[model samples]
Every structure is written in C-alpha cells, then in structure tokens.
Target: MTLSAEYEKLEASINKSISEHNPRLDSFLFNGGTLLALAVTIAATVPWPDNVSWLPRVLAGLGAFLIGAERALNFGERWRYHRRLRDAYQSILDRFTLAVEASGVQRDELLAKITADLDQIRRSQGDIPNGTPLQG
Candidate 1:
C-alpha cells in the first residue's frame, strides 16, 4: 500500500479507539450522576413507613454502592487515558501528513512511533472493568 494509504488506516484506527472509549466514559459519568441525584431526591422527599425504618437506609446504601461501583469501574481514568491517546495519535498523524507532504515520510519510524505511543498509553491506563475491550 502507498504511504498515504497506510497512514490513513492508522488514523482510522485511532479514531475508532477514541470513539469507543468516549461513549463508555460518558455512560459511566452520566449514570453515576443520575443515580446519585435520584437517590438524594428519594432520600429527601420520600416518606417511608415507620415500621420498616430501614427503607431509607437501604436506599442510601444502594446509592453509595452504585457510586462506588462506578468508581471501581475507573471509567473516569479510562476516559482521560483515551483522550490523551487520541490527542497523541492526532499529533502523530499531523506530523506524518506533513512529512509525507514534504516527501520525507519514513514509514518504519512512523509505524514504530505509533505502536510505541499506543503501548505506552495502554500501559498507563488504570484498571478498567472486565469484559470491556481495551481498544476500539
């Protein structure tokens, strides 16, 4: 394949990776926020039976659990990692494009840098939820 073609393929892969990480990140943040808000609202406004006094406590506990679970997933950290990787990839792409334009593109060096950056980013990622793909 031509140098430009290979570069484009790498660009697409990076973009896909960014896209995949972004949604999962947004879902975690949004769900966590919504769950907490709902819990707070229920705790403050919902009047429960005096006999089953544990209801409010249960709700509170559930809320805390949900929040903790979200944190445990480490979505926030993963999101940041993805963003950083995306940016790094973009920078590499820009430089690659410029080098190609200047007729000085070094395919091996470009591929090596991309692979190294990706490896570094993946290594730097915090523990993420199991069963989720590390890259998109």
Candidate 2:
C-alpha cells in the first residue's frame, strides 16, 4: 500500500479512538451532574419523613460514588489524553497532506518526520484508562 493510503487508515483509526471515548466521558459527567442536582433538589424541596429520611443522603452518596469512580477510572484523564493524541496526529496528518499536494516537496523526509512525531505522541500518551497503545 502507498504511504498516503497508510496515513488515511491511521487517521481513521485515530478518529475512531477519539470518538470511542466521547460517550464514556459524557456519560460520566452527565450522570454525576444529574445525581448531584437531584440530591440538592431533594434536600432543598422535599421534607424528610420519619421512615424514609435517606433519600437525599442516598442521592448524595451516589453522586460521591460517581466522583470516586471517576478518580479511580480516570475517565476525564483518558478523554483528555485521546484528545491530545488526536490533535497531535491531526497536525502531522495535515502536514503530510499538504506535502502530498505540493510540488517539489521532500515527501520522504516529511514522512520520516511524521513518523517520528507519531512515535513521540504515542510515547507521551501518559496513563489513561484502557491503555491507548496506538497502532499506526
């Protein structure tokens, strides 16, 4: 396969990786926020009965659990990591695309530079959830 084709494949893979983390991050944020809101709303508006005085506490506990889970699972960190990786890869891809379009450019040298940049990005991905060992 040609280098351009390989780059296209890599771009698609990176896009998939970036998109896969979106729902997970959004779910965490939305659920956490909703739980906290519900807890606050219940505490403010609802009267606690003698038998069932644990509703607000339970809601607050659930919200705390979500926060702890986020700390343990690093959803936010993973989302940021993937975004950074996508940006780095996109920058390299853009440069490569431009090189391909331009005349009298050193395509081979640019490819080498892009490869090095990709390697650097892969190395710098840091500790995120599910191990983003990017395959180029």
Candidate 3:
C-alpha cells in the first residue's frame, strides 16, 4: 500500500482505540464515583435501627464494597492513563503528517522511521491491548 494509505489506516486504528477506551474510562470512573458517593451518603445519613442492628452492618458493608471496588478497579488512574495514551497517539499523528508533508526524504525511509517511532511510542506508553474491553 502507499505511504499515505498506510498512514490513514494507522490513524484510523488509533482513533478507534481512543474512542473505545474513552467510553470505558468514563464508565468506570463515573460508576465507581457514583457508587462511592452513594455509599458515603448512606453511611452518613442512614439512621441506626434499635432492633434490626443488621442494617448498620449492611450499610457499612455496602460502603466498604464500594470503596473496595473503586480502589480495586483503579478507574481514575486508568482514565488518566488512557487520556495520556490518546494524547500521545495524537501527537504522533500530527508529527507524522507534518513530517511526511515537509520532508524531501525518500518515502520508504520516512515511513520506516515513522513506523519505528510509532512502535516506540506504543511501547513506552504501555503494552495494554488497544481497544480491549474494560471489565467491571
């Protein structure tokens, strides 16, 4: 395939990766945050029952569960990680386009170097599979 065509394919792949991860990140953070907040609200506001003492225990358990889920999932960190990766891929895309447009270098050589750079960026960022579905 032509260099431009190859570039376009790579660009599309990066965009698809970004799009998939973004929603997953958002869902993780939002749900985790919401659950944690609800847990806190319940823990703070719910009145203790005199007879059914199990209620407080249940609430505490719920609160612990939410907090544990948040920590275990590490949603906020994952979101940040994905955001950084997306931005990095964008920077690569921008640089590649500009370089290809401006350089008088041989097309094959330029494409090889850029492909190497892209691989390096992916490696440095993390080896997490692109577009991998996040599990709750």
Q: What TM-score does candidate 3 get on C-alpha atoms? A: 0.65
Number of colliding residue pairs in each model: 0, 0, 0
Q: Which runs in model 3 stand beyond 4 Å of their true positions?
A: 23-27, 34-46, 49-53, 105-113, 124-136
Model 2 Cα RMSD, 1 decimal: 4.4
TM-score per model over all chains: 0.58, 0.62, 0.65
Q: Which portions of model 2 miss their true places by more than 4 Å?
A: 1-47, 103-108, 124-126, 129-136
Q: Clashing residue pairs in candidate 1, if any?
A: none
- For model 1, the stretches where C-alpha displacement exceeds 4 angstroms are 23-27, 30-52, 105-136
In candidate 1, position 70 carries an lDDT of 59
Every candidate's lDDT: 0.64, 0.66, 0.68
**Candidate 2: minimum summed lDDT over ten consecutive residues — where?**
18-27
lDDT by residue for model 2 (28-68), tens? 66566557656665664567786877776776676667667
**Better lDDT candidate (1, 2):** 2
TM-score of 2: 0.62
Which is superior by TM-score, 1 or 3? Answer: 3
lDDT-based ranking: 3, 2, 1
